[model samples]
Target: MRPVDGMRVDVLEYCRVLASQLRLAGLPESRVRVVVQDVLAHVEATGEDPVEAFGQPTDYAAQWARPPGVLRVLGLMVATAVAFPGFWLVLTAFTSPVPWGGAVRVTPFLVSAVAGAAVVGGVYPWTVGLWLERRAGRRVGRGRSPLDAVVAVLTWAVLIVLTLVVVQRVLGPDGDGRTLFSVPRRVLLAVGHGGMALSFVLPSPGVQTMPRSPADHRSWWARVRSLLAGTGNRRRF
Candidate 1:
C-alpha cells in the first residue's frame, strides 16, 4: 500500500480500538462516538499517529469515562415500560376485530411485562457498569468494590425471579387484578404510528453533524436563485 493508505489503515485501527476501550470504560455510546470522531479529526488534521498523539486507547478513554446519570436511567425505565405495552397495542390494532373507539382490556401478563421491562431498564446500566469497571480496572465512584459485581448480579437475578413469580402466581390466570386500564384501539394505533413517524424525523441526542463545506454555506434560497439563473442562461443560449 501507499504511505497515505498505510496511515489511513493505522488511523482506522486506532479508532476501532479506542471506541472499544471507551465503551468498556462505561462511557455512553454517544459520547464514545463524539470522542472517536474528535480524535480522528485531530489525527487527520495533524497527520500524527493516534497512539503518539493520544497516548494509549485505554488511558485516553479513562480520561473521559463517566457513569450515566440518575435522570437518564429513570428515563430509560419509563420508556421501556411504556414501549412494552405500546408495542402490543400497536400489534393488536391490526389483528384485533374490535372496532375503532372500542375498549380493549389490558391483561395481567402485559402489566407484568411492563414491570419487568422497567426493572431491567433501571438495573441494566448499573450492572453493566459494575462489570465494565472490573474489566477496565477503573473505579466508578466511592464505595464501589469488586464484591459489588456479585451483589448486583444476585440482586438482578432475584428481581427477575420475583417478577416471574408475580406474573404466574400472584397475578394468576385471569385474576381479579388483571385489567389495569382500557383504551380505544384507534387511539393506540394513532399514538404508535405517530411516535414512529416522529422518531424518524427527530434528531437523536447522540447524532453529531459534520462541519459544513464552502458549498454548503449557501442558503437554500441562494441555491434556488442560482438554479433559476442557470435555467434562464440556458434558454438564452
Candidate 2:
C-alpha cells in the first residue's frame, strides 16, 4: 500500500476508517464508499494520510468495527431487559379488567399508567444507546437497547391520549364508549402504530466528533435557517 508523504499511514487504511464511520452514521454503503474515495483523493492532493488527518486509530476502528459480535449480543440483551416494563403494561392494557363498568373513561390514572410504562421501558435502552455511541463510538441497534422496546408503548400512549383529547373536545366529555371505539378511533390507533414503527425502525445515529472540513460546509442560507429552527445542525448546515 502506498503511504501518503509526511504521514505514517497507508492510503487504503485511511479510506477504510472513513468508510467505516460513514457506514456507522447510517449512510448507504454505496454512498459511503464514494465519499471515502473522495476524501482519500482530497488528502492525497495534500500528501497527507486521510485517517491521521481526520481522527485517531481507535476512533476509526469504532466508526468501522468495534464491540464485535459478543458486545452486540450483550447490548441487545441489556435493551431487552430494560423494555420489560412497557411490554407488561401492554399486556395489562389488553388483559386487565376494565374500570367503571367498561365506560372507556379517559382517566388520569390510565394516562399516568401508560406514561410510567414508557418511562420504565425506555430509560434503559435509551441510556445504553447513548452510552454505546458516546463511549464505544458506535450506533446501537434497535433490539440492542431497552429503550427500543419502550418506543412502541410510549408512542401508543401518546397517540391514545391525543386521540382522546380530540374526541372529548369534539363529542364532549360524556361521549359514550361506542363513539370512543368507533372507526375514527381505529384510524387514529393505526396512525399511532405506524409512528411507533417509524421511531424504532430507523437506524440509530452514530457517534461523531470529527472536525468539519470545507467540503462539509453548507450554503449560508441553509445555515441561517437551521440556526433559526433550533434543530440539530450536525450534518447539513
- Tell me the tens digit of each residue's lDDT in model 1 across 1-237: 022333333665556555655654456666766787787789879988776677655567768974335665455445543443445457756765666668766678665764675465445544453344433322211223567668657776887788778777866776565676777877878765654554343222222233222224467687579678875233211
lDDT of 2 by residue, 11-124 (tens): 554454444445444456546555565666677688755544655433554544443344544454344433433443334344444542342333444444444544434443
Q: What is the C-alpha RMSD of each candidate to the true structure, in Å?
A: 11.1, 15.0
- Candidate 2: stretches off by over 4 Å: 1-26, 29-58, 61-104, 117-128, 138-184, 205-237
The most accurate candidate by lDDT is: 1
**Candidate 2 least-lDDT 10 residues:** 135-144
What TM-score does candidate 2 get on C-alpha atoms? 0.30
TM-score, model 1 to reference: 0.49
lDDT of each: 0.55, 0.45
